[model samples]
Target: AQSVTQLDSQVPVFEEAPVELRCNYSSSVSVYLFWYVQYPNQGLQLLLKYLSGSTLVKGINGFEAEFNKSQTSFHLRKPSVHISDTAEYFCAVEVSTNAGKSTFGDGTTLTVKP
Candidate 1:
């Protein structure tokens, strides 16, 4: 089984501001990086992923991340944020080459104050 440390339980950000979510993981074999966003009482939506390509990967909603192999870190970042971006973010690590199992971070709630 794999594990992930979110580092921060919550992150408060103002409207139209920039934000970054910290994430660290521990694994013996290769792992997949993922960030998911969840609105109030909603399911998680894929923000971005770093599988096996470039270190820098971008996703929907102007979000991007860089996969660091040595540090075992995959941090999520966005230049600007909106009030609508207020949600709970989770960093997950997928283990198993074929059968993927997700181990998610506690959560980082981005409070985009209006």
Candidate 2:
């Protein structure tokens, strides 16, 4: 079994400033981690994922995340954020044995101020 936790429920930042959304996971088995963004009234969009290979993973909209097995964390970061970046972000964990099943965190709402 696996569980995910998004440390912050809301993160407000000024436009063009760097931002980081913290995510942590707990699992007994190997798991795949993913970051997703949800715009208001829109479906979720894949931001980044960490299944294997390098610990660092990059995704759309100039976002990136580093998977740290030691810390059981996969934190997302963007050097510069825009007003358009304002959205709800989620962290998910999928056990390797369970291909499509995933456990998602509550979500972190990022509000970008212009």
Candidate 3:
């Protein structure tokens, strides 16, 4: 079984500022981690993922995340954020044994002010 947790429920930042959304997970088997962003009422968009290889993974819209094995974490970050970046972010974990099935965190709301 696998589960994910987004440490912060909300994060408010000003435009052009750096931000990080923390996420942690627990699982019995090896897993893949992913970050998704939802803009307003729109569907989720894939931000980044960590299936294998290097610990640092970059995604669309200049977002990136690092997979920490020892800490069991996958935190998303952006060096600079824009007002358009305001949205809800989700962290998910998929067990290697179970394909197409994922456990998602509650989500972290990122509010970027101008």
Q: What is the TM-score of each candidate against the true structure?
A: 0.93, 0.97, 0.97
Evaluate model 3: give its lDDT. 0.96
Candidate 1 lDDT over residue span 31-60, tens digit each: 888999999999999999988979999999
- Show pairs that collide, candidate 1: none
What does candidate 2 score on TM? 0.97
Reference-based lDDT, each prediction? 0.90, 0.96, 0.96
Give the lDDT of residue 76 in candidate 2: 97
Which residues of candidate 3, in runs, are more than 4 Å off? Answer: none
Model 1: ten consecutive residues of lowest lDDT: 94-103
Candidate 3 pairs with clashing backbones: none
Tens-digit lDDT track for model 2 on 39-104? Answer: 999999899899899999999999999999999999999999999999999999999887789999
